[model samples]
Target: MTSKTIASSEPSIIESIDQLFLRFIVGKNKIYKEEEYNDGLSEAEQDDKELGLPAAEEKSGWNQRILLEVEKDRVKRVEADKRLKDKRNALLMRYFQQSLLKVVNDKLENSESVISDQLQLRENTVELLKKLLAGEPRYSVLASLLELNPGTRNRLLSLVSSEDFMKALGRDPRNVRDIQTAIGMIGTDVLRFLVPAILFKYRINAYSHHNTLFAKKLWRYEMTLGQTCTALMHDINYRRPYEGMLLSAMVNFAYVASYQQYLSSFEVVRTACLDQAREKGEKNRHDFFYDIKTDSASLQALLVSQADLKLSLALSEKLFQKSFPHLVNALKEEVEGLAYEERTTVGKILFKAVRFAKYDQLRSSRLFKPEWQDDYLADSYIEQDVFKNLLRQELFRFKPTWS
Candidate 1:
């Protein structure tokens, strides 16, 4: 008789998420220098040069920085064609504007700082925002980019730094060089936990229908999905992820916007569900929809919704093409090169990843009340037992944000 063959199973979903989180956890990505450095200049100088900025002429105790101010004096008057077409996105943007307004107003003025609508950002943080918008300092993408290990601060300063990463956002590396030679300029409060929270008031006015400022966190969450989809796309097609990444960010954002009002409406359900689920076993619980993220049907329907995607694509082009021309064009070229089926598959993967991220976030916050239902496991793409186990594994991971 021929020897029987048995295939070993893959990691569960819980395991995969755990694996991914650990893979991307802060400081896990270490910079590996392929060549030895012999330049007499210190590591700090080396880093500055790597970012395409001029190193200090002489070692001064204080680093000379070219401060770039955020343009608040003039109204950002984008033309009608140049306007963000997504009314929801426009609404969310108003959230950013109001949030900004709270910190900056014409009535109150000061030389040392800029505060509007009672929101006070450190003078340095405002500078950091300028660098981020200008794509300068390279590390601006990762916020403060605080590194645990000085010896090896991720692949480049931190996981999200480096010109290549930001280039994926359609920005020019050249623009970064002219802004400021000095790097690591901001290193205090905002870096630790401010920028996102700093702009927000603890007691927000309930006036606007789109008052909730959860969109920032949603951006962070969707970016993770877009990025992970980029990785998965590369795994399938073996092409660089620039196109997939940019396109995915736009798609993910639109889908997230679809849930804009839902995000707020879910709170009442969440509170009720939490109370109902208390002291009850899974088998004994009543059925209830606890999340405003809506059903999978809406997600699947989004893929076929041309109107939804077109508005988003148009807005994305209008909003970013000026600043990130290269990144946007890269996606166009890549979409042409890739097969339609492949791009669709990438979109599907992104949808799946965002659902996973949302599930994990909700579960972490104790709002994922229907714990008994593992609907994602039933998706046709992950039908195999190996994939099923992978889904199971994701639940074991710890929550880093939104907890």
Candidate 2:
């Protein structure tokens, strides 16, 4: 494929209100490999992907080690900038986010990012998983899971067979002699939670390695975000709590996919500019540097593209509407931080809920910024008292047990 080209003139960039928060959400997942999204690709576009690039310049092994290690070591000094801590730390946070994703992208290229070597999904698995989330019957869901992915079947069986899992369910493991018995005891309500929990865990959680720094933290944030959203929605529509969780999952999935696309797009642009510079015998990559991360005209277009999430998620938008009708527009408006009075009921709740989730996450990482925490405009929607009450919850402060 031919390389992607940048516009001759810079495009006008619209800055979103959530820009500060999204900079912290950039962890890796290879949404490009999902297949459904890549249909009808031009041959040239395929070539571009086959040649999809990395941003950092190649260096000698020892030199590279020193470069990366030196950058890693800079965290101390960056964090120590007491006066400029918020801004400088925010920059380092963005670098850290990209570095975490780079680690995942590298592992994916080497075929090492799969959750488990033996785990696999079927061609119709997405459809079936959607049905499963929509509260299909346990027998049908299990049968579909068994027929579609033996890896899932084996794993589910192993989970149900575990002493701790069964003990949590208030069952004696000795009484649950087999998968059939365990499934029988668990009932459909529990199965709905477990089955979707399993798929949802894999579908959107993008950590590629156990040792990676943000692997568990990002996963934990995603879970807590969804849970926090679900709890907030439940306060209003108590009957639709499960649907609320599923909707949050869709948002988180889109969020991750958009980040991946932005990184890929940045690489394509940076590679093209660098290639042209090399042909001209230019030694520096300064031309494209200003257009990407920090200084850019079309900041959203050049960096994280919040616009992409308005498109189809891995699951159907129709499915999301059936559960949460106002949610679709809320995701779009939340990016811009629409005024609370202007937001729909769901939007008002979701916007605050998501911000709260991120606030909780950053606090857990000890990266909380007083600027966001002290914002009067944000507190105006959900008063400071309510925000404090929500943050005081155990789920907001600690990682979920599943994580």
Best by TM-score: 2
The backbone clash count of each candidate, in order, is 25, 3
Q: Any idea what lDDT model 2 has?
A: 0.48
RMSD of each predicted structure: 27.1, 15.4
Model 2, residue pairs in steric clash: 1-44, 1-47, 13-298
Question: Highest lDDT: which candidate?
Answer: 2
The per-model lDDT (C-alpha) reads 0.36, 0.48
Off by over 4 Å in 1: 1-213, 242-245, 252-310, 317-343, 369-373, 383-403
**Candidate 2's residue-wise lDDT over 1-403, tens digit each?**
0011256353211122244334433322222222322222453345434543222454444455444677655644544553264465446446534544444334323221221221123335545555655555567555655556554555567776678876777765544334545566665555544554555565443454321333354456656666666566655764444444555655655444433433344555555555766778755333433343421122233224433444333233434555445666666566445666788766676666666666676566444545545553344356776666566665533221221
